[model samples]
Target: MTTFTDLNLCPELITTLKDLGYKQPTPVQAQAIPLVLAGHDLIAEAQTGTGKTASFALPMIDRLSRTPVEGEYHEIRGLILTPTRELAAQVGEHTLEYGRLLGMRVISIFGGVRFDNQIRKMKRGADILVATPGRLLDMLVQKKLSLAHLEMLVFDEADRMLDLGFIGEIRQLLAYMPEQRQTLLFSATLNDSVEVLADKLLREPKRVAIAARNSASQQVKQSVYAVDNGDKADVLSFLIHGGNWRQTLVFTRTKKRADQLTAELLEEGISAVAIHGDRTQRERTAALAAFTAGEVRVLVATDVAARGLDIDALPQVVNYDLPNQPEAYVHRIGRTGRAGQQGRAISLVAPDERRFLQDISALIGKPLQLQPVPILENGKLIEGGKLPEKKRNQSGKTRKGGANTKAASKAAKRAPLQPEEPVAPDTPGKRPSLFGR
Candidate 1:
């Protein structure tokens, strides 16, 4: 029964939310927004579509405007650090759109863009500054901006930052903030390092967990297929060709694979595009725009595009390769089944990934129905674990996008790697039908 108006938010912010057509706050928003509006440091665990952005953004904008202080030039009042440039840009855009009604200045800072432009913009100072750790550090060292005036610090994807080895750099950035700033750490799930960050950065923080551990969004229905690596593309093509599916998001493990897969899909008359770290800011933005606009029927990407993707009614997410980490499985699939719509997540697993698949199923505490692999044109099982002789023959040196195998040329390289982990399924001992030709 709690609505944005009932949360004791400022009238202006309430108006903004209403104008944006968000009449009710999400669970995270309803609970955390009140505490945040009270200037309390918070740790909120919510999935991608849970409106966590407004949970923090509305309150931050209100506090900056309602509470008057000696704001200075070239000093940011709030800092939100995310793990990737795409996320940073997104948060910045959201802040700008929502905070504009309040006449606020919001700026996004991340690497892969010109320093001159960011530096020029930073001179005037900003109310909300969204950034990536690396670029923030670079700007800090260059004396482009100072954080001494910052009143709020948010780690949007703390666990991701840890996985990306930014703790050291985060430590460096933390040293520059005032000891008495409000902190908000939001992520899909918390690992040990994130716990450490909350313990160290927050002061008497209120912890709000909207999602349970190892649980993917309920909005998404997940399934898997145990097939040989050779048949992944064929299976994907079949799924698209056979079903009423309109938009599908496919995840690969590396940038190189993303590019190659996109080309492969195009060759098969399927419109596809790939996004990764190697892509320029413009390229990534264009690809995402095209996908959102339905110009691209399928999107092939690495983990870089997995997190912080805010697509609505995405419908389908194909784990062309399962993620090595179980948590990533949650985020990748979360792209679909968003905003309370039904969505499907499908994983293609090879024989070698059986144990890994089991691990993930165990972690989620449910059995992922295994779709039997359809018969390929050839009367074989489709190289479940090994690379197609064609892929190997095409590049005996191995595809640059495959999993890291340089360390062990002796392990008998398989067709790149299909990701996996060993966790129990939510449904107990449920044996799914394994499909094969």
Candidate 2:
């Protein structure tokens, strides 16, 4: 029964929430907002769709607005670092929305775009800055901005930042900011790496855990289809066609795999697009936009590229390939079943991926039941039996590498996702398009 008004947020935020049709604070918001407004460093563990952004943004805006900075040029008072460009853009959008009535200026900076416009925006001044670490560091080195006046620092998706190997960059960025600022770390899961970072950065932080650790959303009905690696494409096509899925997010482990899957889906007469690190910003943005607007039926993405995707009412998420890390499985399925909407998460597990599936199950503290793969033939849907056991050497043990290592190697070399021109360190701003348009 806790409401935004009861949480002691300012009237401007309350009005904005009402305008956005948000009646009550979500669990994380209700808990973390108060702590943030009270000027406490916090470590909040909440699921992706649990309003984690608002929990920090609303309170940060309120606190900053109460104490206006005295200067003709607005200095960056708040900084939020995200793992990927997509996430930075999404968080920037949300922050702008939440603080609009208060007249807060928010800007997002990431690589893959030219720096001229971003520098111009920074010169105009931003009250809150959302940026990916690499681009932000570039700006700092170039003397385009300063974080010395920052009053608050937030690490959104902290676990993801570490997963993307941004720890060193994060540390380097910290050296540029004032040490006295209030720091808030929000993540879906808090593993040991995150714990170490939190210990180093926060001072007697308040911990808010909105859900069980590494747990997938209950709203997501998770199931697995056991199949051979070679038959995965056919099974996926059968499922999509048989179920008549309109909007689906598919996760692949590698950029190469994402591209291959997307191509295969298109060849099957299914609308699909691939997004990954190798893609240019313009391409990534367009692909995401098309998928969001339902112009594309499926979006195939690697784990890094899909980190911060926010799709409303996404009905289905297909794990085209099981992730190497079990925690990523939770984050992948999280793309669907968001904001209390019922969703389905289906994983096509090859025999080699059974171990990966088991790791995922263990992390989530629940056993994922394996379902027989479905076959579509003559316009009929039928069970296709369990997956065959992994191939073993004559010694009766699973092969050390894989059965078709040579073939896999050849495929990887032949069809690698074409990498875009590298973003030159000095001219990062010249790239086309920002993420999350």
lDDT of each: 0.75, 0.82
Q: Which pairs of residues have clashing backbones in candidate 2?
A: 113-429, 114-429, 114-430, 114-431, 115-429
**Which lDDT tens digits does candidate 1 get at residues 1-437?**
88888988888877887888986878888889889888899998888887888878888888888754455553578889998888888889998888877778899998888989888888778888999998999888887788988899889978777767677687789888899899998977887667777888889999899889768888886767655665566557656754646799998866666777788678768898988877888888899999999998998888865568778789999988777677788888878887788998888876666666777888788887455432232322221233444542221123233421222222233364344343212112322221110
What would the C-alpha RMSD of candidate 1 be, to one decimal place? Answer: 10.4
lDDT score, candidate 1, position 148: 89
In model 1, where is the ten-residue run with the lowest total lDDT?
428-437
Error of 2 at 178 (Å): 1.1
- Residue 322, candidate 1: Cα error in Å is 0.8
Query: What residue runs in model 2 are displaced by over 4 Å at the alpha carbon?
Result: 375-437
| Per-model tally of clashing residue pairs | 18, 5
Q: Candidate 1 local accuracy as lDDT? A: 0.75
Query: How well does candidate 1 score on lDDT at residue 383?
Result: 19
Query: In candidate 1, residue 196 scores what lDDT?
Result: 76
Residues forming the 10-long window of minimal summed lDDT in candidate 2: 392-401
